[model samples]
Target: MSVSTPMLVTFVVYILGMVLIGFIAWRSTKSFDDYILGGRSLGSVVTALSAGASDMSGWLLMGLPGAIFLSGISESWIAIGLIIGAWLNWRIVAGRLRVQTEHHDNALTLPDFFSSRFEDNSKLLRVISAVVILIFFTIYCASGVVAGARLFESTFGMDYQTALWAGAAATILYTLVGGFLAVSWTDTVQASLMIFALILTPIIVIVAVGGLDDSLAVIRAKSLENLDMLKGLNFVAVISLLGWGLGYFGQPHILARFMAADSHHTIRSARRIGMIWMILCLGGAVAVGFFGIAYFENHPDQAAGVSQNGERIFIELARILFNPWIAGILLSAILAAVMSTLSCQLLVCSSALTEDLYKGFLRKNASQKELVWVGRLMVLVIALIAIALAANPENRVLGLVSYAWAGFGAAFGPVVLFGVCWKRMTRNGALAGMVIGALTVLLWKDYGYAELYEIIPGFAFASIAIVVFSLLGRGPSEAAQQRFAAAEAQYQSK
Candidate 1:
């Protein structure tokens, strides 16, 4: 397919707009704190949308729709699981984490929060948690890079290698320049673009397919099994799909939003806004894939790209069904999804390196100016590594995302949950849970045992380890307990 001139113009304009936002944010970033956490000043709307956009990533538009297109309604279980998980996260973790991180010395990053929460004078918790974040988030960032490369390759008729760097350049530049503020501000815009594209595209697809009944009839004609939610799925398989929800607790990028909110009082509103946005976007994504079966079935000639890669369903639908200009804007949502998540993941990795490892270990007295520059440099380093990891054109976005998601969910989920809710959780117990949880995921995924999602066992094992270790060890320090009580009081009041 030749490159459409309208699309080229739209893409160029969109990229320039994001870069402009980065420069605007750069002026507002006066210190390392401002650079990393936007000075902890996000309101309900920005916090809500930024978190949603960062959480969804390109997987929502590309990977998820692709899964539904290939596997049918059974795949929607993942979305259902995610909704449940996200809602629970907003209700249970958001406000508490916001207040807890502040009470525990105003920690800016997850590792910082863990180290401070446990009063780990040795900094072992800081070091280990930072390592865990870097390891898993590198893989997570690579998934974003892969998703971006796919969009560029398909949309612009570019080859995979050239498309890879071209796709990542804008996101890297903005993140490097403006840091967290840039990422969060752009996320708000990107979230709006994403929701619009998602909602509108599916409506058009449904209409083009001649209605819901007709779409279902066409899908049934293609494969009656595709209509069954439990078609070829065993009980374990269904559970595995739903287990995706468990990942929210430990996602560094999404959790960062909660920690950045202006106050705990805003979280309730943010939660409501975020959940509504998430549900609508997810519903639209699922609809595109399900109805796409009918659309492509009725028009096989236009489906060569989708046949080659079901992940292209959303992209192909946008291009074929809308005017070139509108399709370009719609397709930009894919880029939006890719950039929103990638930028934040890059920033999180940067924070782990700059705050947790560099400043925590090497330069405890590093100046704000120096630290901000170091953080920017780390973003460049991680982005290059992720791009290299994403060099393979054959990598599936969903496959890569799931592996990394499970890693974080298993490793940090139980620890974070226990840390905020259980003041009795000792540093040793936290360490034990973190290490055992991470190791469980790595081993479980490697062995491919039980045909179950690795997170299920990893989360369970981690939770049990935390309890046993905490019970066996001495309790938290007096300071730690006092801090927990203070944060809990604030959370309750809110």
Candidate 2:
């Protein structure tokens, strides 16, 4: 596809608008909390949309569509798993984390929460959790940068490295100025645009292909017999795909929303709003890919080898179904998905540096002003590091993302679950679990066997290590254990 001047104009204007929002948000910052969690006062709609937008990211725009194009109906289960898992995370983690962040930890970041909860004043827990957060978050943020660059490379004929720098800079600059406030407000707006684009683009494609009857006939004539959504996929693949669902309970970026929300009262409303938005958007992505299949089917020469270029399905559909102006708007929606996620990831990475590392360790006496500056600086440094790592630009976007996702899921997922639910969870248990989970992710990759279940193995070992280590290390001294018993009682009452 030729470089459409209209599309270029749309992208530049959208990028500029985000930059303006970032600086606008920058005006409100007075302390680290304002920089990190928007002063811990996010409302229901902003919290819900930003969290969902950040959570879904490039995966929703490109990965989901690719999956539908590649595996047909079985891909839908992945969406189901995510929906259920997200709802549960909001139900279980959101409300409590908000209250506990103040009462138990005074925690602004995940590592702070861990250190405070266990009376980890020794700084061992803080240091370890900070290290864990940084290592995995680095890779996680790289995946987002990769996705952003890929979006430009795939859609607008931009060079990968140029796109990488542009994309990373775009997210980093806003997050630097706006911090969490910019991220949340921009994410809410971007998330809405994402859903609208997903819904509208596909509907247009379906219509352009001449309705359901014509579309199906075209698809049947062109696609593989197995492309049928129902009879097309095998049970194991379906299960594996849907198993992507189990990942939500542990993701840090998603969990951050819960920790930041102003009240538990917001959670119920957030859940309803979040789920409805997710369902519609995810459904739209699938429709775009499947309908793209039909649209191309009707025009055989035009449809050529879209599966291999699966990432372009959404872009191709925009060009085929709408005039340049509408297509430019839809294209901006894809960029929104890319930018929303990249900004959120960058902010989380910055928080780990400011709240978790700088104040917690390096400069123990750093002022709020210093911490915020450090956080902003870390954003550029980290984005540059990730861009350097992602220089290869040679992997499937979903696969690379899953590897990072699995690492975090294994490393933090079980420890968090056991920590929140099981009071016997000793500090030693948390350490053992983190080590085991992190190591297992590396080991699994070394063995090249993630085809089995990327996060499952690491999560299993982490859970076992936590139990074994906690039992082996002597239950907290009697007094400490008694104090924990109160925590347990508090847990039971809740």
Candidate 3:
């Protein structure tokens, strides 16, 4: 199973292109601010595409499709939930967060925003929130590593450990050198590649497997339930699927896009573009999995490769449907998805370590140059940890993603929403919510609450804790209320 010369060239070029973008961003990055948030200067298109790319991650290409391929249309509900959640996040959180983060002491990171918003002079909120971010994001980053390893293992016949390191190397290199701007720019390119491959491959697959009606006939002959979207969808299942949207409010990588947009005015256009891209790409992913049934039915030999690994549907389709050169580019889309999300996660983790832990506690007066290098060092450390975690071949991309997504959605989502919307939200309540929500997710999953997603219980408990704690406390400070009012006014005027 030697790699084709064309595919090797295509992959090398794609990886080099990413490194080149990092170099370009490196020249413009003058300070720690630029390294972390691109100096908050991204335009609407970059903001929208970067957010979408980071949010979707390898899960969009690998996990969702695999779920559909393995189970049925019931899995598509996750996509539906995500679309709703993303829309709500954009409409409710994006512009307000953009304004609030700036007004709240010009905070640059999520923990920074939390500590500033709560007026926590003792930095309790910052430390707790930063710790939560590190715990969940490490698991999240491992998902991306596993995804990358899977691609190399299946496509080029590499073993797991070698492929894991190979897949992680480029992302680590570029992210260490360039930081936020590099991630955002590469995300834009990767988003376009992802959408292109998703769109093109689905249409070609449908045509190759006869028309829609014919494909449906073939699918029905094998298993009628595969096309039944409501076959096993219960109330709990529906709620769990929709709960994916809750993760949007708390995802550091995606929220960074909102905070970095050049202005609040760009949010409208970004929302429209981002939603359209999400819907189309999600539909394309479903189509790939659904049509894959028919294609594999007709060619049982190729199906054997995917017998236990339905996640490889996209890869197998590309290999079988296109010529070697074109297949290489399509496969590169998978790499793009993996790198786009991995780089964002690593950068976010680095920012937490450097800004919250290192700068806030240890070196409050550190120079910008010194802070930037520390941030880069943190990236290398986190990447090594994630690579170690992903070295286990039993790791499934979706399983790791699910656990981390629930952790963030429950722990941070309610608190973030209340901080921006409810002026009564005290720092005590924010801290309580963060701690309780995270602990609930951990306990729920550890105790085998697999009947429903952890986000449902975690989000509910966290939201309740916030309300109860805020009522018991003295409430937000006068200064905090004033900042909230200012942010709301800006939102209304816009």
Candidate 4:
């Protein structure tokens, strides 16, 4: 797959722009807060789009479309589940987390928030929470790398090993240079590019397939399941699909966006904008996969090539439907999706290492400048670890995402929910829930029922653990209760 001159130029230009943004962000980043959470200064628009972009990742362009391509509308249950989950996460968690993190001793990280919320002088909660973050985020970051490699491999015809490193090089450079602000700023731009590609590609594909009515006729004739939203959906399948929503509540990357917003009041505006963008983008992704059936039916030559790796449907559609110049831009959107999420994940991992481990334990008196440099070093280390994990050529973007999603959802989701909403949540109960939830995900994924998504079982067990242990053991201190009440009151009164 020789890269055309236009494609090479456009792609190079896009990568350079991201690098420039990193340099700009690096100049503005002054404190550890700015390096980790953008100093909680992001406005509504940047906050909303950055969250959306980081949340979607390459799965939006590659994994979701691939699922739809192979399984039809039945696969859309995942998107439907994510939409509902994201809405509830914003409505319930967004405003409170923003206010709570600030009120809880100016907590800058999730582990810090939990430690402060629980009043754990022992710092056990901080250690445990950070460990879980590192474990799951490494896998989560690897998934993004694999997705990027897939794009380069399919689009540029680069070999898998070379493509893997090439795809991650720009993201690591920007993240290492700029830190959190760079991730957020780049995310906003990437979100725009993602929506443009997702929206425009589907519209053109639908037209090429003849029309909405004609496309539907062809899809239905080809495979009724492709159009049938409810075909073969059982109780287990529905719960497993919808359980994806549970994962959002605990995803450190998405929650970081809420914590970084300028103010709690800004959440209302961000929520509306974010949800609207999510719905349109998700609809477009699904449309691309569904519409591809008709497009490929007419062009059997392309269809024959993509049959084995249906995940390439979006890439193939962009290649076949547009001129080289426009296709280059559209394909760059895929890279944008990959880099946006990958950079954010690396930054979060860096924060856990620097803040939770280094500053909190190794050198409590470390200066801000020292910690910032430490974070930059950790980002490179973690990105390299993820690159190694992603070197495998057989990894499916959606498969890796589902596993890591389940890990976080089951491990931290229950703890985060009860920690914020329940005044009685204790450090002991929190520990039990965190351990039980994380272990449940691993054990269930490996040995428990393969038919159900691990999140359902992991979440249920962890939530039950919190309730049972909190009742059986000691409750939160008066200080913890008052803080919880204060945080709850801020949102409830509004």
- Candidate 3 per-residue lDDT over residues 287-352, each given as its tens digit: 888888888898888887669789888888888889988999999999999999899999999999
TM-score of each: 0.97, 0.91, 0.97, 0.96
Error of 1 at 253 (Å): 0.8
Candidate 3, after superposition: displacement of residue 245 in Å? 1.5
Higher-scoring candidate on TM-score, 2 or 4:
4
How many clashing pairs per prediction, in order?
0, 0, 0, 0
Q: Which ten residues in a row have the lowest lDDT in candidate 3?
A: 393-402
- lDDT by residue (tens digit), candidate 2, 191-298: 988998998887787788889888777777665552555555466555556556657766788878877788777777888898889889988888877777777667
Residue 367 error for model 4, in Å?
A: 0.7
lDDT of 4 by residue, 410-486 (tens): 77888888877788878888888988988888888669998899989999999999999989987777777788888
Tell me the lDDT of model 1 at 311: 88
RMSD of each: 1.8, 3.0, 1.8, 1.9
Better of 1 and 4 by lDDT: 1
Give the TM-score comparing model 2 with the true structure, all chains together: 0.91
Q: What is the alpha-carbon lDDT for the whole of candidate 1?
A: 0.92
